[model samples]
Target chain A: MNINILYAALAPIVAILLGLLYIGIGRKIIARLQRRYGPPFYQQYIDTIKLLAKKTVSSHGVFFSLGPIMGLAGSMVTLLFIPFGSAAPLLSFHGDIILVMYLVVIAPLGMALGVGEGSNPNGSIGMARGLTLMLAYEVPFVLALFSVVLYTHTTSIAQIVQSQAGEWSLLKFHGFNWLTFALPISAIVADICLQGMLGEKPFDQVIAPHEIASGPMVEYGGKYLGMMVINHALHIYIETALFVDIFLGGGPVWFFIPATFSVFILSLIINGVLPRFRIGQALKFYWGVPLILAVIGIIYTMVVIK
Target chain B: MKQKTEQKKSLNQGGKNMTEEKSIDFFEYFIGPQHPGITGNFGVILNAVGDEIIKAQANPGYLHRAFEKLMEQRMYLQNVPLVCRICVPEPDVNEALYSMAIETLTGIEVPERAKYIRTIVLEMARLAAYLFYFGGTAATLGLYTLPNWSFGDRDYILDLFEELTGARIYHIYMQPGGVRRDLPKDFTKKLYSLLQTLKKRIKEYDGIFFDAALFKKRTKGVGVINKDMAIEYSVTGPNLRASGIAYDIRKDTPYLAYPDINFNVITENEGDFYSRVMVRRREFEEDIKILEQLIDKLPSGEVWNRYPMPLNWKVEKGDVYVKVESTKGEYGYYVVSDGSEKPRRIHVRGPSMTHGIMLLEKLLKGQRIADISPIMFSLDICPPDIDR
Candidate 1:
């Protein structure tokens, strides 16, 4: 059986559908937390369809149209690199985790480029904040990844998952996970950074609906928004899947739904109960407590934990 | 750092750039007739050099309905409904002040029991408005949960209002001499319970919103108004109080039953955004305390004065001004009668006319663009107040 050909065609469609479903469910969950009768679980699909059905607007230029497509493509390619539990990476390589980290950026860069072309100052402000926040959170997140990679001695996510088969990474040795517990600080930092990475509340300055008019998405309408929405959905899945894989052991493809949901709910609850940080405050916080935690976790892993 | 120096050089270029800011590095963003952070049909034209706002022009009149001029055409009693629409968050202050001014003009003394009832409704209205202000200010800092919770909590207050006045938002219950009706049966008992629920919820809110790390970080040192500036701008209500003045219309110039009701004048020194918000939070407790006093000592008697409020009600040729401590600040009304059915003039001085426009323009200059909403919300600017 030729797995490459099979996955190339099927994976993106399946991933996209699953991504949309997750987003739909996520909205319902957050809505319930606020004690409102939320929109239907399939609301994202309906919203996307509605957006697509609307008449197109005059584009700022060729770049504006290219932005969404490029963003979607960047995410799709990143999705292919992330292994779905037991399944091999669609394009596996020795240091694909690093590649995944850098590739994840392409989507936002695409959005930034599109926003730049639109010439909205608010969008530029929002993009600047987003990029600044990205710098803030990425450090701790990368440090957490480094802790795991150094401990496991493998940069490939597939190899890391395979190594965890005898015992899930969270409960590797007699219900005591070295990476999570021995240096609990790293895991805690990762959890906090994940909130920012997913663009939830408290860290949702970029999509600030009131402040800057949904920031970069202000001018987008019809198919442009639809493209961004689908891209957003895929972005959610990729990030959450990455978190689950690194910490919770992505497990078999069968456990993917439940595992991904647990992480989603955790992120959702954190998002629901808190107020937002100004971009400056968010930067200061990321560099303050979380950065210290990541540093301590890395030292512990290097000196003793591993 | 580089951009600042470059912008400085460009600013020095000063020829065509001075004539048109559009040609310069600066750009403008219209934050509202429909912005989420905006209060009613208002907007702010923010000119920015990078993320910092250089100038902010307060845009009002989008929600204007000329209530002052409208009052001139309507009968004395008829204008009561129109004045309440001036500030939507706490309409009772307008109602109370309008009624007081009219009472002074007509030389009609309100019944003692009606005064007590009016006092209770006013306190409840204050609580309702504070709840709204808290929720709204939190929303500006990106706390959606607080609004969801606070708005839900406010409905409990509204439910109480509906039970007493038969209307939720625009009660239109207060007339020239007194309120439209007596308290509903068991209304006092229900209010007692609602206060307890609110007290508990306020504590929970403290944990989730007020005490949250991000909120403190976002608000602290952000929109500081000095005592001198506060007085200069006539920034009344909690905003002025936040700048260290313990002045309150309820305490300073008592009306209705407030002269008898003892309460603390909540004040703060720093007058920063957080101080303004905390002042409102403390005032929430004070409002509840005042309501409790009104409930405990409520007189059981007639709730209206002995004047038939005919549609064509007339008053003598006299003018009087009355001010009430509203949720936003000192809401005032001046009414003049020409011994006819209609009033000669009626003027409203809403606190937001000062806070939302002139003070906002001052506070916004040189501040980060993100702080505009917080500063506006913390000041408790009701755009309808300005627009009206």
Candidate 2:
């Protein structure tokens, strides 16, 4: 029940395992889409280990070192907050969803800090872009989060998941049923928008290799780059876990296997199928379409239930 | 309000302050040497009134490799790889132009098929380089998605080049008297299919990227170079053609197989940043047309001549200047041979040296800071051209 000790004990191992699984499935899906063989599930683990074992070089600042550490910490926090397979979460408290929101944001903030501290103007520009993207997506995301919390009449994610066990909370509650459809749709859109903000292709605007020469990563080399890579992998892992827990509740006994793997495959398939969105277009989609969807979901829940 | 002092000073000083007060304001910024907005390793000292650039002075020679001087010291055969480095984006043009100059000087008539092969390679390079233009231009306008799409698509072209020339980017495949090898079986079919694929993609690209509101907002009328200014600056290629000058070296001079092909000299009436980008976009379509025709009418002959094994070959004492309307502009190579295997003097008068450096400096002055990249991309300056 004590949060700190529980997180200290299980966070790194679970996070690392989930990170590897996520990367493994992601690589497989991307490979399939590109018509090639994806790497083994543990390839990312091997890569991280090799990078960490190598000598580190610093061209910029202490933030370069701090970025990955904080990113990993942020991901761990997100992982700890999620209800794994049962009703109990690793960390539980009233209004903890707010904590989760802030916790999820820390990775990008840490990354932006690290890149800005690296003193490469490209990195700074990329940080600015990443920050702007956070602004665009986070507002609607938080609003959607509030809508879900409102429907359940509880801020505890465990309670919400438990409520779903009987008849699926989304459908069990008659008045808030529309909130379920709307929230998931908005969440998926938000996540897709955030993925680009996370610097994947099509949305890899901040560090376009040829244009800004890898943007914020332009000056990074050796182990510093390795840490950034690990940080990103972990971030994706935690974000997907959160998505699974919120939208696609833990299914049958083998649900975690399929649910977790499916999310990774979906993300990769999305990455392969779509090109990047421009900054303005991205902002417009997140703030415009996703915001409208979140509003409709909230309105449907309020009018139907309470 | 600040004009009062200036008016008083001008009146007191007999109206001479306009010409005499040429010093830059103390808050001037020099964005180059290692700065954004520049095409490559060069600098421009800017006198800015806030974000507005009041004056811009061109600074060159950072990437300057003394290529002409380097060319003079190398033997004719040894210079093949050396010349290709002159204009990195369109390196094949350098090889073609240099070899054409050598051919003209030595009176070695290349086989008809080799000429066609050379023409295809040159046009492909032009297409690839224009794709690069789309990337750079789109990025300049903050439509970052266009660059990603264009660059990803560009790899397809590079894939073709890799298969054909055994190297991507700098294909040192074009040699004197012809190409290094004959076209592989079904090379024309594959090329045709690739062109068709590129054509379909271009339409989608036009809808999503080039025709977007942001592109229009950033580029339209931002940097307008009229026909007079274009002529005065000696701007060529798309920039010159955009200003309504229909002077294309391929059409005007008709070197290699350009004379045999039926392609129009694409011209735009407006010489602004948008017009320049439009001209290149139109030219991409034109390049597809040229490639289609080249494949249809390709002649049958030897791809190359023995040419005395290159290193052993010698040119009689003579001077010649060969010009080709490359993707950029008038790519001219002037060579003076003293009846030796090596040339006595070689000068690469690439268009970028004038357009990228001199004309860029002139146009960038009095423009806003955001306008810098689009204008630079509009000129399509291959930085290596200036370095050479």
TM-score to native of every candidate shown:
0.93, 0.76
DockQ of each: 0.49, 0.05
| lDDT of prediction 2 | 0.72
Off by over 4 Å in 1: A1-3, A167-183, B1-24, B306-309
Can you tell me the DockQ of model 2? 0.05
lDDT of 1 by residue, B161-265 (tens): 999999998898888778889988999999999998998989988998889877888888889999999988888988999999989888888889988888999
The candidate that achieves the highest DockQ relative to the unseen native structure = 1
- In candidate 1 the C-alpha lDDT for residue B170 amounts to 89
Q: Which residue pairs overlap in candidate 1's backbone?
A: B237-B329
| lDDT digits (tens) for residues A1-306 of candidate 1 | 797878877877777777788888877887776667789999888888999898877577888888888999999899888778667778887899999999999999998899878776667778888899999999988998888888778999887666555444444433233246545777789989989988998899898876877888876889999989889888878887887676766366766667777777788888888777778888998999999888888898898743
On a 0 to 100 scale, what is the lDDT of residue A217 in model 2? Answer: 67
Docking quality band of candidate 2, CAPRI definitions: incorrect
